[model samples]
Target chain A: MFTLYEFASSGNCYKLRLAMAQLDIPFQRIEKDITRGETRSAEFLAINPNGRIPVLVTPDNRVLPESSAALWYLARDSKLMPEDPFQQAQVLQWMFFEQYNHEPNIATSRYWIHVLGEQEKYAEALAEKQQKGHDALAVMETHLSDRDFFVGRDYSIADIALYAYTHVAGQGGFSLDAYPAIRGWLERVERQPGYVAMEA
Target chain B: MFTLYEFASSGNCYKLRLAMAQLDIPFQRIEKDITRGETRSAEFLAINPNGRIPVLVTPDNRVLPESSAALWYLARDSKLMPEDPFQQAQVLQWMFFEQYNHEPNIATSRYWIHVLGEQEKYAEALAEKQQKGHDALAVMETHLSDRDFFVGRDYSIADIALYAYTHVAGQGGFSLDAYPAIRGWLERVERQPGYVAMEA
Candidate 1:
């Protein structure tokens, strides 16, 4: 009974869709085209003042924005979220890292290059983003080298949060060839039950 | 029983120190000077490959990084975090907004201008950051206009997360004259029990 306002191509939006699919939660999807100014409209602003997509309206009509918050809401008390307090904090640590470290560089670069098709105009910004994006991936690679998942040996929402942008990093001009551990981990996440791919 | 690796002036690191004080938790503080490259040392990198401070080593010697994650851990069972699932998500929503929308612009600009003293070299980036920082403040003003706090009726870590960078936004060249609601909210948070100010 949840209604999700999203932009399909956005990895932030995709994180919620993928999480719902894995949790077997039935929800309605309403596409908001940012390029066409759908998200900035007065009507959409009423739903989320932030004017961003991937907002989840609950069955009771409460509006929840922010994809990572939505993922934590949907997965809490489920196996996707750990029971241990420390483990839960660890999962949150990675989710915060995805938002703070990974998304700004990887997702923003992908939007500029792939969706907006303005790579030349954003050349300078993209260069800085590419370097930082690789640094984020390197951190993930090192973490994954000794662990199969970002948290406590399980496929949690932390995996979903990081996976959304990372799987499509090439769209942002990032190469995965050097990250063997990340590659293996990506495949492991894909093998999880009810896993859904990001739509084109 | 806890060891905190932090940078004294960083709002991100200060969030942890402030939270621990409000919660009445005792911990040892170890300051790592990022300007002096303390965070990038091989020894520091071993604890957090991300090479960032505000890392909390738990009583069991488990290392945890990321300021928001540390806030969640320290406040999980306390009144600082809500028990209701929906309220908890709302708290997290604001926390994410602080990290994604607020911090990057406000905190980064402050670092460049105040700490690094390189406003001239980062002029172009600072201009963009200033605009976005104002936008983020606008969003908070709208939200706070109708509520006493970010989530529910009580103060939570969401306020702490946002308050960290915002209280000193003037250092980043952002004026608070237009944000009356945010100004009032800041005072309310300062009046909270056990509240601690960021160290000089």
Candidate 2:
């Protein structure tokens, strides 16, 4: 069995859980709370020098960190990944967009507000992320305006990457009311086969 | 021929130029000045809703943005990309790391100080990024201490992704004197075949 180091409440970690469940890949998860500094423990740091969670240890004991990388690893030769080379790159396009543009703003805001209860402390940073977060959502809204998914009009890891944080953006004080296309896509993602709701 | 929209000096844009040069993929270039707000122009926004450079239009007219994604597209079936499944995921691991940890801290610092000439204006933010950039460099140092390349000990897109910002980190006030391993890796990258220097 594969071993997963994760914080249950984290969307990044949840991306792996959701994918493994969807792919029917079995793995045992060990919860490491980031807020409590569990991830900073020397043992945890040994697995990932980066000191982040959602690390996957392959059955052969090969360790991999970074949620998208782990997800890409799990999606290989599976339906979650595309066969077309261009579509595969398109999957990467949105995954990078999520990490660079979306997650930093959207996910961090949620971590500050909902997870850490530090909305007041991070108010200034939160304010700055607000506009950028919406810019990312607007990009998604426009893209999804015509297509059902981010690439090849199919639900792939790109969708999973974005959906991890987007579904709970309201927790970060982001109102998705104006993004009809994004809302529509979120609903479509929830209905995919073997889709498991993120555990609270 | 492909059409590359870029800001010539940007490491992100340079990634494509370098990759295409090494891979022997020819493309026409159009320079867009981010400092002058060229990327925010409507024409540019229509091409890339994210308002970023390093957008590539394939010969068939398919538009792909995000530097790593474009690199993956160009590296298809090439030596720059590994064929092994796990190694491919490892490549994605470092590329994502470049986008998240390295670029935001290191490259953004270079942009503000070196390109935009606003060191005084961004002093506080620059200070904050300094620690993070070094932290990223530290992680790289540890990883490269034993390995010549990032994945499979080969010059893949993973190295290209990090080298773009890292090689010129000095311009952003990052000192490589303490990082012997990283220095060695950078020199190794410079020695790769078909390498073309980024035009200033």
Chain B TM-score of every predicted model: 0.98, 0.99
DockQ of each: 0.93, 0.92
Tens digit of per-residue lDDT, candidate 1, span B59-156: 88999999999999999989899889999999999999999999999999999999999999999999999889999999999999989999999999
Residue-wise C-alpha lDDT for candidate 2, range B21-74, written one tens digit per residue: 998898999999998999999999999999999899999999999999999889
TM of chain B vs. native, candidate 1: 0.98
- Which docking class does model 2 fall in? high
Q: Taking the tens digit of each residue's C-alpha lDDT, what string does model 2 give over A123-160? A: 99999999999999999999999999988967899999
- In model 1, which runs have C-alpha deviations exceeding 4 angstroms? none
Report the Cα RMSD per candidate.
Answer: 0.8, 0.9
Cα error, residue B29 of model 1, in Å, equals 0.5
